[model samples]
Target: MLNKFLDEVCSHIRCKMAHNDIRAELTAHIEEMQSAGKPIDEAIAAMGDCAEIGAKLDKQHKPLIEWPLIGLTAVIVIIGGIMAFTNDYVMNHSGSDFMRFLLFAVLGITAAAFFMFFNYTKLRDFTWIIYGAVWVIFIGSLIMGTRGNVSYVFLNWIFIAIPLLVAFAGFMDKLRGKGMNGLIISTLLALVSLIPAVLTARRAVIFLLVPFFIMLLAAVYKRHFGVNIKSQKAFLYSGLALTGLLVILSVIRNPYRFARMTDFITNVPEGNAWLISALRDAISSANWIGGADIVYSYAPSVAVPNLMADFALANVIITFGWLAGIVLVAAIIALIVRMFMITRKVKHDFGYYISLAACVMLSMQFVISVLMNLGMFPFMGVSLPFVSHGGTGYAANMVLVGLILSVWRRNNIIGKVPRENKNIQPLVEYADGKNNI
Candidate 1:
């Protein structure tokens, strides 16, 4: 009778993903009725007509298409294409760079579409495997690198770092109930992600480590670690202190890094000073709408090598004027703000963690890129998310955006049981009276 009833109810539900949840809920309702001394028939009848109940559930569980996010993404993509095209036209006097930009944008959009439909929950089953794979690849690259291949081995760590960020969130989900042991393990796991930075690019490592920690802190704050409030706070401070100590130690040990850190403060135009000087001058001379006067007077001086990649934001400001740059930065910030807001709406642990991770990572990269261009921060290997011309970086960011949208799409359907009511397990037994049926 139960199986037959469920089949009938599920027949009315169009979303197959909601079927298991519907079954669990309705079965629990019937079990409650039975506990109240009602017979099986009475319990089954207690639920409303199967079709009506299923229809209502279907309505409640339908996927949400967040138009605001879609609109924001469209705006950024269009603006990025314009910025890339115009900058290329000014620089190379041809459309080759614009053509390359279109190719990568298409590739990125395709990746976004694929991950948007991909069931992110499936990543749970292989979370540890994914975690291990990231480390293996990171380590293997260095081990396999010969002097001739050093550039290949170390430079592309961003690809490895992005996966680590995603996988770390899933890993945190797996550690939820383990208490202090889980906290210690997660700290170690996160710290390992930073060690590679000392050996490779610190900027790429910062990209992974900062966002990775943000997710960790968020998880702890949300009580995902099953730790008490006091322990959570302690963990938070301890993590921060450790990070500070590491930074101090690294700066003291590395003269080049220390010098770069102090350059902004000391007003010293030493290493990479020419690029920074040109960027500052371009911004100061740029008109509100048209191109910078500096560019017209002496284009080659301000036309740095990475005008399309690491310094795309600067290029936008110099080529299209400060107003255009401000609008672009504001739009990117608004998008990141929207993503962070969406994290609060996510029901599942994995969804919230992953989305938060991506949001913070994107936010950090965007902030650093802006500051770097403004000469307020040292130049780094960071890119302005979608506006940058690097194919790999753009595609990776699109993947992150796709993952966030995926979580938001299913926000209504994949319901989470509240912590307070978690012990009331639904008796989903199928064995009793099944043989007779």
Candidate 2:
């Protein structure tokens, strides 16, 4: 009878993905009634109309489409396609580059769709596995030894860092209520994760490290790891001190990097600062509607060495005008804001952590990338999200988007019904043995 009732109820639910959880929740309620010595028929009848109950459950558990985000992503991809077209045809004169971008764009979109439907909460159970996988990949990258291009090593770590950090969030959650020991353990793990980036000796590590630290410090600030307020403050101070010390040590060790920094600050004409000057000059000379003549006169037709990736923003402003650049920036900003909004609506702690980390990472990448283009910050090889032309980066950004969408999709649903079933309520009432709506 209970199965029949469930079947009737489920028949009204359009979301088949939610059926198992709904079944489990309804089963728990029916079982509770049976344990209370209520007749099954009476309990089933008292639960109200199957169709109405299922309809309400369906409404509550319905997947959120996040169309605004989706639309924005599409618009940005179109913009990227235009940039690729321009870069290939007008600049590189290689007809093949645009097709490559198109292939990756399709793959990225497909990846996002897969992750959108994927159950991200399952990641919580495999936190350590993911953490270990990151370590293994990092080791493998080292063994492979750059293979003539250091980007091979960089790519391996870059793709893994986001997921590793997300897993760290889950790891931290598991340590809640363990007090100072938990804090120490989590901090150790966080530092351990930084080893690969540090060993790579790439400033891009800054992009990964900053966001992960934000996630860690945020957890500490909220007392999520069971540390008292004073201890949290001490942790914060200690972290800042450690960061400063590491930065100083890094500069002392990498004399060439230090020289580049000094040159940028001193405005040495032949140093890396020239890239910044060129970017500014191009922007300054740009007409608001068309390509800048100054850029074409001085630089390659693409306007920069890495016009498709690191300095894509400069190309946008130089080739398409500030008006087009502003629209692209606005779309990226909207996507970041949309990701931030998702953090608020996520009910599950795991989902919340993943979304929050992804948001912070995306926001930081966008800020740093823009700064790199504008010459406010050193070029750390940070690519603009979605707008940049690296296949790995494009795919990684899409995966993050998909994970966030997965979180939003299941915001009101749970994979497992709690044993107590406190949130489960009667769908109908019985008054004087009469069915009441």
lDDT (Cα, tens digit) per residue for candidate 2, span 343-411: 777766667778888787778888888877766777577888788866588888888888888888888
Q: What is the C-alpha RMSD of each candidate to the true structure, in Å?
A: 2.9, 5.5
lDDT on C-alpha atoms for all candidate structures: 0.76, 0.75
Error of 1 at 58 (Å): 0.9
Give the TM-score comparing model 2 with the true structure, all chains together.
0.85
Residue 427 CA displacement from its true place in model 1, Å: 8.4
Error of 1 at 65 (Å): 2.4
**Model 1 TM:** 0.91
Off by over 4 Å in 1: 89-95, 147-154, 266-268, 300-302, 417-437
